[model samples]
Target: MRCAQFRTALSARLDGEPSGLPEVRLDKHVARCTGCRDWLARAQRLRAQVRTGTADGPSPEWSARLLVRLGEDRTGEQPPGPR
Candidate 1:
């Protein structure tokens, strides 16, 4: 299978979805393909970050701005400008 297919399967696997490809086949391709290996590593890290909500998780300031905007949407008022 091509690298793209492998990468797609890798993403599916990471997402706990069925890849439709055998795990052994995926492992063999990743073992021989440097790009796939790197991709798998990066995908794993990203999955970890997403699961923990800390992959460059939103800053407090950003969260505050979002909250303010949401409140404004409900209240029909403009959000305050940045300080």
Candidate 2:
């Protein structure tokens, strides 16, 4: 399956929704795909941030970085920073 498909499944899994795809298949893909793995990590972080509301909201730097990461994701580029 393409990375996009796997990403959709990942989002569903993260949200506790059925992905209609087998868990093993998704796991296998994430295992070897660095881009998807990174995407998943970023998504989890974003979710956590949302759940734990900040007093003043996300910082400008954080927002900008997120936008850049998302743009890179859409273009299939590996985002800069930690793996």
Question: Highest lDDT among the candidates is held by which one?
Answer: 2
**Error in Å for residue 58 of model 1:** 3.3
Number of clashes in every candidate structure?
Answer: 0, 0
Superposition TM-score, candidate 2 onto the true structure? 0.65
Q: Which regions of candidate 2 fall more than 4 Å away from where they truly are?
A: 55-83
- Expressed as tens digits, the lDDT of each residue in 1-83 for candidate 1 is 57999999989998899998999999899999999999999989988888898899778778767878666544467767765
Model 1 off-target regions past 4 Å?
A: 63-76, 79-83
Worst 10 residues of 1 by lDDT: 69-78
Quantify all predictions' global Cα lDDT against the true fold.
0.86, 0.87
Best by TM-score: 1
Per-residue alpha-carbon lDDT of model 2 for 1-83, expressed as tens digits?
68999999999999999987999999999999999999999999888878887435778778778877666554468777776
